[model samples]
Target: MTPPPGWYRDPKAPHLERWWDGTAWTEHRRTPEVTAPVPVAGASGRAKAVAVTTAAVVLVAAIVTGAVVLGQGDEEGAEIETAPTYYTQAPTTEPPSPTPTQSEPSADDPAVVTDELNGITLPLLDGWVRPKYVAEDDVVMTTDGTYDCPADGGVCRHGLVMSRTVTSNDERSPEALAKEDIKEAAESAYDRDTIGRRPYGGMESHEVVKSGPVAVAGRAGWFVRWRVTTAEGPGGYVQSTVFPSRVGTESPVCVRYVFDAGADGPPLADMDRITKGIRSVDDPDGGGGVGSSVGPGEG
Candidate 1:
């Protein structure tokens, strides 16, 4: 026997309903009425409207529950990424780490060494270097860098120049100071350097090589030079040159030089040449290494 015409589960889509006529399935189909309200057989208009509203709310609840429960797993099924409410959380994260930094020095160039207290600049000769973190504050320049002292002590350099403003002494004459400082200059540069290495062993004896008037930075100056023989290595020369500064209280400024007499030394003529190259820092053509009048930090 065949069932009478009515709505029933659809053959093609089990979740939907279809209508059957007396003889065959009809084209009419709809969602299964799983959550639709059921009304009393005698319900009036207002009662039916209330029932419909109730069903809508229940239908929404069922749909949310289904999504939470049935939507769990991925290869199997993935959980619903969103919640029943409006707000959803953004993925958690952290910012990238910060980097560190440092600064490289620009002291490689053999630059002009300055005497700020005296308003003058010293010129660098070939093979000379104005190094960094190596010489003392009073040291303005040196030659051929440095090496292990033959004495097996500290380090040693073959040639050096130093400068200082004349203060703390009652006598201000350039000539007196130049003569007086020669012995001390020789002792400091050859007998023993700052680090206490006697690179020339020790000053065995010295004789005045020259004593005369000179000029420095456009000012009259006096200088005393000595030829020093050491107990070790080749002999060398030491000079103390002093002049009145062109700035400040016109205080005298003293410049000293020590040159190795070995084959590797700068020619003795370079001492006079360097003195001649001295110029006022304020001069238009003076103190130009690193392209400008740049002051170096204490070595």
Candidate 2:
């Protein structure tokens, strides 16, 4: 009868009774008893706020996958520090070029053509063998001829009017008349005992079968073609000379010709037509003109 403040067990409940009230335990009624106090129902607090927003969305997706794997390992360590490295260098070139040379003419080259023999001329048959006497110390008296050139042999009779001898009687000093006309043409065309018996006789004994330098009329001359070897062999003698120092003393003259030996003649073509037909018998006070008379059968 006294178990009424809280839990009690009887009627064959075999000893169960809890009734303390001054401090704890009191939901009475034995094993069939349940004390009520759980009452939060805002739909179960919205299912506990949906499990705390699914644990803060799995902790912000694991801190954004550890900041995208530490920004892909800091972009693979800045792409291995911006890669590029290789070695072996040597190559750079340029150098090579030069060549050229050729030119000749000079021995005091005065338009080389010092006449020894040029084209022979004469009053030449049409002028019908004139030129009879013309000599001023040497000798030129033409009156023995019959030349008809159709290549030698057509009709060439004979010819001679030799004169050109000046061993310096001071032929009015044109350098002693060119050293006495080259020592009188080396003593009448070299015959040093028949040029010491032939065979390239010391280069045909000072061979100069023709030399040149002539103006003639206006004074100034030098022509020569000398060669001799008798018994009808080598014979070519042509001489020309003119010296008057621009007409002061006026008396140096020589012209000769004797081309024998088969005479197809070519002593510098007859001493360049006798020093280019020497002329000038007038006009002398220096205005040029003094080489007069030349007649190895004048042309």
Off by over 4 Å in 1: 1-111, 135-137, 195-197, 285-297
- Model 1 clash pairs are 73-77, 73-78, 74-77
Per-residue alpha-carbon lDDT of candidate 1 for residues 1-299, written as tens digits (9 for 90 to 100): 34456665565565666676745667798886665467779999999998897666554433321012356457877643222221123323488787866533143434466656557778778887765555554667778677665553666677777777767587888899999899888898778767676766788999999999998888899999999988877778999999987777778888888888878777888889889888776665544222223243455
Q: What's model 1's lDDT at 172?
A: 84
Task: Give each model a TM-score.
Answer: 0.58, 0.23
lDDT of 2 by residue, 113-144 (tens): 11112211222211123234332223333335
Best by TM-score: 1
Give candidate 2 misplaced runs (Cα > 4 Å): 1-169, 173-183, 186-190, 193-215, 220-229, 245-260, 267-269, 272-274, 277-299
The local distance difference test score of each candidate is 0.71, 0.38
In model 2, how large is the Cα lDDT of residue 197? 35
